[model samples]
Target: MLLAPKLLRSSPSPSALIAMGALVMIELTSACNVVRIGERKISRKLQRKGLDANTALLGEANVHYWDSGDSPETAGAVPVVLVHGFGASAMWQWHEQVGPLAAERRVIVPDLLWFGESWSRKRDFSIDHQVETLVALLDHLGLQRAHFVGISYGGIVVHELAAMHPDRVAKLAIMDSPGRVYTEADHAALLARFEVEDFADVLVPTEPEDIETLMALGYHKPPRAPRWVHRQVLEGMYGEFRDEKAALLARLLEQLDELDERPGKVTQETLLIWGEHDPVFPVEIGERLAAELPEGTRLRVVEGASHAPNLEHGALVAKWLVEFL
Candidate 1:
């Protein structure tokens, strides 16, 4: 596969700008919904594998969660919460990051309000609101501090979480995410690209067909993804079954409307992670986001992978996360 790589342009000790090393990894030949993960761990690993991991509640919709290490008792064991991207659930993003992090510290994965089993007709999916909900989740679990790992839209959630409730967050890992002010072309591209497959159109119901076509153009290897996952998510996008999406999209659009051509509040120890081959937001955006943070923030670009590096190149993503998270 053709590869592109980026490095952190900073000195660890403020004296010398170290030349960060570059690495090349394999591009898998097949599209896997999940490469085997969460198998063994010191954190509490349950049998809720795949969609089977779903948890539901009556009045307060149950949010499915996976945890490895619990900080409730241990001193050094702080939790790491991973969030997914737009139109995807937590399972879709952290299928790889979850299991490995669970090996040592507590790794918590929750399907946000709109996506997965956490679907609610009342929950707000606005970026800020979602971050608030995340913080509340931590509070509910009696966790006061945790490392946050969010991808794409999820990355933005952590940005808000760190900014709004800085006391609850310990560190941040943002991967291939869009910034506070997404440009016209960039925003349109995010909303318009849907041509990866017929079902991709169905997945983003508002414009599933467009999204499917966009995927074909955006993904380094769209064909590498299975037709079924695309189909189910696509159909769910606009299908009669996704009323939750309608409510979520409404709030999300409200968030876009509230934007004022600038990033407002921000405070957190941040690490920006990106895929060198990412066709979604690309490396430039990642570089910009890292630059916008504190002087010492880090950026790592995984070579030979695209938007969903956690899926395409999980091990590499996991390796960096093991150290960063």
Candidate 2:
């Protein structure tokens, strides 16, 4: 069974307004990067939780990850690898769940190639390449199998990984990812909903307004913040590797048909977590995917949630993941 958290207020509180004002003041008066400052704070928290930042060079790609290094408390537990979506790095995306999930079992969170410190010189940005890189990262860590949780685009990657190398994946959790079930009509409708000709404009945000659009689409109750703060996020987080990221999005869409053509269903027992009002990939897609998967597959919809429930309801999502994995 899936548990739901209390719905967060859609409107901003007075305290939130005051904090936003202070952030604007900081942006105007100081040279400190607001996004980086926030990232550093999150990094310190994760460090305190026993996750160490490290890098693994996998031939063509350099993968940067946070590992809850081997310890007696989690010695015999199967490691859980958290794969983040298109927007920010893994740390920024999975910060909330990391501490809780890491407390019981080893958790490995890696920055996907072209995001954070992980990157590849090879021009290939297909999902298959991403799966290969993640497999290489696992091999580098000497982990033969692990439970995988992937959100958004990362979901597509992990789905491909499980399908291509079923032996490498013990259990799978897909959060708001469309996978091969996304059809051409779904792609067209997504563009029409966002009023953009290219989906990359929606995913690979380049402007402050783009970020606003993303938050609006991703969350049921998007947090209120000033435009300058959004600009800071755009510059600090989404600015790097803009072109490559756009290319990656394009390649993903282009390769969908190819992926669908491949044979066989994912044999591993799967869990699907979706936001009730996900505008990007609607909950209907999740229902369709669940029916197509193995007999034991299940879909758990979070009430009053949007595209990224893990961000909006992190604790609940983590609880479900811990129980399922």
Candidate 3:
């Protein structure tokens, strides 16, 4: 089930009108509908790369993904699954990566439940539920094992997936996610850094300013776009499932607190990728996590990149993934 563009019928709020005024004052009329246009272009690019937008009814959710077609070029190639983070969908987040990675291996990128087309009637928002949905996706696709790459929130999901079902994961790559190493202090600091009582206000953005703050934190060099662009992004991407996503975050925090009572280290070889100046989960967290994992676990720090190195330096991240996996 490919996601259709949302039809926003409501009138623009006071802040939105002010943003429009700024856009008009700047005379950037040609940049209207930037988000929608960008989505269409990304869809075209994925199609050109031999990836078809697809969906599978896996358990309770409909998992929407981009799959490199089963052609002769990639018939026997090992599958690689890319899971996106909280804010954006799979296509927007993994656009730069799919082309390069799919050239050598069959790449599958799925939108997590409640983020894109994937959703469920069940109220369970635990990490275990997310892992189960992903495992069901693999089973539905007839894939016994595949290399998994996850970013931020997606990284936590993949980590749990790898730990819970070792035989089903060939290798693991976690980017900017501290996994079970995330501490109570880290959570409190995150709330302080954002100056918000609830972390959901930072991750599940409600306004253009929220988006700007998220981008400033996530990117080393955040894109300089008009306020209207941020408004469009807030509406197009982060507007839906607000409460459900907040619940997911709450569950994640609870899981982090209870990590010690759960399973220990995973057996599979893991690759830990972190940004040099990640304020969300700093390099120290990555280093600590690397030590706690299996003996051969490797950590790679992308210099000058903040929370999202994969977005900041896509080619370099893709190269590392190819070498490590």
Candidate 4:
């Protein structure tokens, strides 16, 4: 079963939605009471407002984005585009690369469809549709393509984008991505994990000071997630229509069940990056992606990082990407 918080009708509020999600469970027990108290305590400690960011409506979705320091024509600078993973918005990950990468290149970070303020007009979140949305976004911005960097589930989109718009993609980078072979077992595990007692500690986040605690259960030590980042991540992601999100994910899994993981139609240049400690997809998966991708794929790993090498350890990740691309 997928976990969706009922409180999010349209979107999640800033602080209240964060704490309440931790306490939203099926079981009514004394343990839940304790969890509620803990949530409240954390909530009081970190009462945050919404994130200060810009939004551009793409189709039926609100594409939340942050522009890097320089622009394409900022006197001859290559543009870099960043895409986030599942259950996360642009603000959640890319901590290390988005800002610093902007120093030399123009960076464009947008909330992917189904995860952030962005939505799918078809109410679908398939790889094909996601790739289409990205291509449309790029066309909207009047760009052919830039350096593409994505993490975890975002890697799936990177793969699709490269396959769909090889002409648009200049260089591709994926970190600990669930790019190929999205198994049903994986979905089952995610569903089971979401219902656990300390699920919020990982998914919803219980510790205001330690936002990384949210990914404690993950393989790699989740990157250092900031409070404001969490505020935007939680609100833009997991509020309202809880049941709908769950159903949608389930439907997506069902749809992926029939699709080809190794679509074998890729032509984009790619750099595959992974963290050895990644808890979710693990490091082994990265090697598998290298084998499946079209030729000229570069594979590298970050030592201390977890699922998101770029966010957990952005500086070095940026160095590798800046050099690789």
Candidate 5:
């Protein structure tokens, strides 16, 4: 069990120690199942709007997702898959755009491994396995090719899919992700920006305060909410599978070194959307990606937005996606 850092203090009263012990017990118990006030509302709203809960029994896991639109094989509409970053789930990340996009295209939003209701019994948490899992899901849905929209970590996975199986992917859009290979220099720069030695220190949060810190880092204007709301969100979204997620993080670090050491030229026409004030991967990264990608790739910047332009500027991002895809 990971211990929260102890505050250095003078000798505490017996009552205070007892209260602390009780709080620890509550936290551990709630880690398994805590009803998040805000998340529940948003989830229900998304479901009411059109997103339906569905499950796919893949090889190693039973993946749960909120899917919209008919399968690609059966429908004539263009297929578009939205892959979310490291956080809660597809429900949380793409809730704003799902309905709007589903109207015109066949939109599929999936929860990545160890996220939402998705989990793997096999110990393989490498990026290659993740790529395989997604491919399997696409196969299950009878999709041979589709446009992909990814945010942050999800962007990396879609970029990999395009590189490894270019014929299987049509168009690609990446937001707030370093699609290219990251180097030792990039690692140092991130650590310096976050004032943390490891990326996990910033990406993974154990406490409510840590979650808020992550939000502050990711968003230019973090939402103001009550303390209890933040705590509930953390316990509900991140408390489960803590160990597995940490293991996955370790595997991802190794894969970044091996799989994306030096990305080859991506031939597919790409649309890169970035927030002007993105604190995580700055606009410069997007500029670099545009230059590195083949000619005809476009970069669209959203002013006043942060890491997640989709959430910050949903209508504009949706317009771009519809036009680009």
Candidate 6:
């Protein structure tokens, strides 16, 4: 049974604003104990595909992850770390890359704090915290350095890590991310385009319509699924980590004003993969992002794809990742 979370922010409508004041009260009483059957099955199937489920205590958070075991062959193979975005766990986000990449390399995929089984009550939800936590996780695994692959929000974290800890990153791959601090105008325009009051409403969807809106914006050719599937996913995959994600985004936005719009100088080798028809970030942003990075940063545009290109064209994305990393 898929039970949906009742806590949802409103669209940019008068009716939505009317109930905004009561959001806190409603969230206090709202419980997110839903277990999505479909996601559960996928998780198990991924485990069988050699992505072993594991957990590690990093600071106050207990991070759940999928690990392709480190072995004699893997010792020489490059370690590739996959970080997920806002909506789902690492398993759902990088399902395609894990199995294929693991065949030749060591892959580590982790659920960021406040997503999946990772949770913490600490109010410090900056992107740097995630970077530090991930660094610590890498340290715990005895990994000195690895190539980093991130998408959307995860890409932002990878960017920060590459900028702050250049020595620790061998290669960086960022997909469909803003890549630089977004200007206030950029933020306002995206909100207007999405027809939503805030990002939390869209990223952590509560209703099937919200999921539909996310899909419509995320893909140039959105996958067709039954209404029940969206509902189950909304209830199961998106129910947990409501307030925490909002706080995390809020903190991330707070840093935006502090950073100049121009991309900071990053020393590591970089690969930027984007969707040609990305409605969320747009292809123009990718062009500008490429110019902002260090010399020789390569940009690859996936034709006929959108924000979530990895999902829309998994085979193409996997090929790019394999070649880049």
Q: Which stretches of candidate 5 lie over 4 Å from their true place?
A: 1-35, 71-75, 260-265
Clashing residue pairs, candidate 6?
Answer: none
Who wins the lDDT comparison?
2
Show the colliding residue pairs in model 2. Answer: none
Q: Estimated TM-score per prediction?
A: 0.70, 0.90, 0.89, 0.68, 0.84, 0.85
Compared with the true structure, model 1 gives a TM-score of 0.70
Model 2 per-residue lDDT tens digits across residues 224-268: 888888998998889888998998998998898688788655889
- Give each prediction's root-mean-square deviation over alpha carbons: 17.7, 10.7, 7.0, 11.3, 8.1, 10.1
Alpha-carbon runs more than 4 Å astray in model 6 = 1-37, 261-264
TM-score of 6: 0.85
After superposition, the stretches of candidate 2 with alpha carbons farther than 4 Å from their true spots are 1-32
lDDT of 4 by residue, 1-325 (tens): 1334455664767775655656554343433343344444433322221113566667765566665434344436657888876554565566456545666766777777656566655766466666777777777777777778887657777777777677888878887776655576765665564555332334444334334445563435444655655554444345533444554455555665665644455667778888877666666767877887768788888887766666667689878887876
Q: Give the C-alpha miss distance for residue 174 in model 4, angstroms.
A: 0.7
**Residue-level lDDT tens digits of model 3 in 209-240:** 88888898889888888888899888878878
Clashes of each: 19, 0, 0, 9, 0, 0
Candidate 2: minimum summed lDDT over ten consecutive residues — where? 1-10
How big is the positional error of residue 188 in model 5, measured in Å on the Cα after superposition? Answer: 0.6
Off by over 4 Å in 4: 1-52, 69-74, 182-213, 218-237, 261-264
**Model 5 lDDT per residue over 81-158, tens place:** 899988877777887787677777778888988888898887787777777888988898888988889999899889
Query: Judged by lDDT relative to the true structure, which candidate is superior, 1 or 6?
Result: 6
